[model samples]
Target: MADKQDLNAGFTGTPVEQPEGLAKAAQSAASRVKREAYAVTAGARDHPHTASALLLGIGIAAFGFGYLLGRSSAESSASYWR
Candidate 1:
C-alpha cells in the first residue's frame, strides 16, 4: 500500500491530530450558522451611506465627463476659427 503521504498529490499543510474537537466545533457552528459568521461578509450588504455615496460618485463622474467634453469642443472650435 502506498503510504498515505504518497496518496496525496502534494498537500503540505498540517495534518489533523484531533478530529473530535474539530468535529464538535463544526457541528455547533452548523446548527447556529449565520451569513455574517465569516470575515468575507464584511462588506456583503448595502449600508446606510452606500446609496448617497454612490449617487455622489456617479454625479462626480458625469460632471467630469461633461467638463472634458466641453473643453474638447471649445478647443476644437477655437482651432477651427484660427
Candidate 2:
C-alpha cells in the first residue's frame, strides 16, 4: 500500500491533443445541424397550419398509445390480485 501514489498528484491542466481532422469534422457537422434547424424553422413559419395539424395528430396518437398501455397494465395487475 505504501507504493501507491495519490491519484491527483500527476494531474496537469494542459489541453489534450485530438486526432487530426477531428476538430474540422466536428465544426462541419455543427454547421450542417444549424443549417437544417434553420430550414425547419423557416418551413414551419411559412406553413403554420400544416405544422399545427401535424403536431395535433402526433399528440393524439401518443395519448392513445399511452392510454392503451396503461389500461392493459392495470387490467393485468387487477387480475393477479383476484
Candidate 3:
C-alpha cells in the first residue's frame, strides 16, 4: 500500500520540472515566427506601394465600422428615452 502511494508521490506537485521536449517545441515555434516576420518585412520593403494601399483600405474599413456602431447606439438611446 505504501509503495503504491509513493508511486504517484513525484506527481503530487512537490517540485515541478519542465520536460526537454516541451522546451524544444517552444524554441521551434519561436524560430518559425521570427522567420515569418522577417519574410513579411522583406516583402513590405520590396513593395511599398502595395503595403500602403493595404494599410489605407484597412483604415477606411475600420472607420466605417466605427461610424455604423456609433450611429446604431445613438438611435437605440433615442428610442429608449421615448
Candidate 4:
C-alpha cells in the first residue's frame, strides 16, 4: 500500500508505450463516417408515397399509444384484485 501511494504521488517513470491496433481503430472510425454520409445522401429524397406512408405509420403508432393509455385503467383495476 505504501508503494502504491508513492507511485500515485508523482510521475517517476519513462513514458509507457501505446498498445497496437491504433491504425485499425482510426480506420474503423473513418468507415463509420462513410456509412453515415451514405445514409444521409440516400435518404435525402422523400417521394410523395414515402411521405404518406411515414405519416400513416406515425398516426397508427399514436392511436395505438392512446388505446394503451385508455386500457391502463382496466389494467390497474385488475391488479387491485390480484
| Top TM-score hit | 3
Candidate 1 per-residue lDDT, tens place, 33-75, comes to 7654543245434353775677799999999999999999999
lDDT score at residue 30, model 3, on the 0-100 scale = 94
Q: Rate the local accuracy (lDDT) of all candidates.
A: 0.74, 0.88, 0.88, 0.79
User: How do the residues 1-82 of candidate 3 rate in per-residue lDDT, one tens digit apiece?
Assistant: 4676567644446337554798879978999999999998899999999999999999999999999999999999999999
- Segments in model 3 whose C-alpha atoms lie over 4 Å from true places: 1-26
lDDT of 2 by residue, 1-82 (tens): 4445545576577558653598779978999999999998999999999989999999999999999999999999998999
Q: Model 2 — TM-score against the truth?
A: 0.59
- Point out where model 1 deviates above 4 Å: 1-46
Residue 35 lDDT in model 3? 100
Superposed Cα deviation of residue 64, candidate 1 (Å): 0.4
Backbone clashes in candidate 3 total 0
**Residue-level lDDT for 75 in candidate 3:** 94
TM-score of each prediction: 0.42, 0.59, 0.60, 0.36
Off by over 4 Å in 2: 1-29
Worst 10 residues of 2 by lDDT: 1-10
lDDT of 2: 0.88
Candidates sorted by TM-score, best first: 3, 2, 1, 4
